[model samples]
Target chain A: GAGVSQSPSNKVTEKGKDVELRCDPISGHTALYWYRQSLGQGLEFLIYFQGNSAPDKSGLPSDRFSAERTGESVSTLTIQRTQQEDSAVYLCASSLVAGGTQETQYFGPGTRLLVL
Target chain B: AQSVAQPEDQVNVAEGNPLTVKCTYSVSGNPYLFWYVQYPNRGLQFLLKYITGDNLVKGSYGFEAEFNKSQTSFHLKKPSALVSDSALYFCAVRASRLTGGGNKLTFGTGTQLKVEL
Candidate 1:
């Protein structure tokens, strides 16, 4: 079975530019999540999407960070006016269920973003 | 308000010796604990989790974790370490309160495990 997959293994963008990272969750996974790994902040959850419901954006660092998951499949994380501090490994994970103790999130290879 | 802590940034062990990676967590009620390992340039792989019943939970690659409610710790252990086991180890925790983000896991800074021969 194919695990989660993220596009653009590496991206180097200007500090003020916008960047979009894509993720393809495993087939039939109803819950998807985005997280970032950085030297300064370690690992932090960015956002989550569960079948058709309003996405949980509480973990998003700022307004510039947004994500959209359409119909329980693909997800896109966009950072508008990226800052140098946004440089990090953006990871995507998906689980069978929305939220529960039994939910085990499988992670993707991650998209490394370098905001220069 | 749930959080996890890996006290030591790194743990060094001999290939044939016992190894232990410390992990402590703070959460509201009954906590669900998990362990994950990450090789360089790869995503994290789930190792094991503690959700109920027994205090001792076994996981992949001969690894296991013991859950201690009184100590608020879930330490990963292996009887004999392997050189290939060297990698970044993360401890995560989630409270079973069923709040909006309560099920969302909180990970520690991670511990670097080095197994030498």
Candidate 2:
């Protein structure tokens, strides 16, 4: 079975630019999530989407961060006016169900973003 | 609030020796714990999880984790180590009730494990 997939494994951009990262969740996975990992740091939650309900944007670091998921499939995380502090590995994950506490999330190979 | 801790920055072991990567967690409610391994330049791979029932959970690639409620620990262990097992390890925790609508995961700082031949 195909797993979660993210595009543009690596990205380098000038500071103050905007970047969009893409994610393709596994078929039938209604729950999608985005996380960030800075160098030598742990994973930080960003945003999550379940079905067509209002997305959970609580983890977004600031107003400049946003994400959208069309239906239950593809998702995109966008960071506006990126800064040097925005550089990190962006990771995506998906789960079959979004309601349970025991649900397991499968992760994708992350996109490494570098701001210079 | 939910949090996970990997006290050790790194763990070293010789091939064929028993290995243990420690993990502890804290959550407001019931805790669902998990373990993951990450190879360099690769995505994190799930090793195992502890939702409930049995305290000892078995997982992929001959890996296992033991859950201790009193200590709030779920440590990853293997009978013997392999050179290929060297990688970064992480412990994660999520609250049981889905009341908040967030249900986000809280991860640990991570521990680097090196298996020497």
Predicted model 2 interface RMSD: 1.3
Q: What's the TM for model 2?
A: 0.97
The digit string of per-residue lDDT tens for model 2 on A1-116 reads 99999998999999999999999999999999999999756699999898978988989989999999999889999999999999999999998987585588899999999999
**Model 2 residue B106 CA deviation in Å:** 0.6
Among residues 3 or more apart in sequence or in different chains, the pairs in candidate 2 whose N, CA or C atoms overlap within 3 Å are: none
Error of 2 at B116 (Å): 0.3
State interface RMSD in Å for all models: 1.4, 1.3
Per-residue lDDT, model 1, residue A98, is: 61
Model 2 - which docking category?
medium
lDDT tens per residue, model 2, B1-117: 788889999999999999999999988767888898999998888889888899999998889999999999999999999999999999998888643525678899999999998
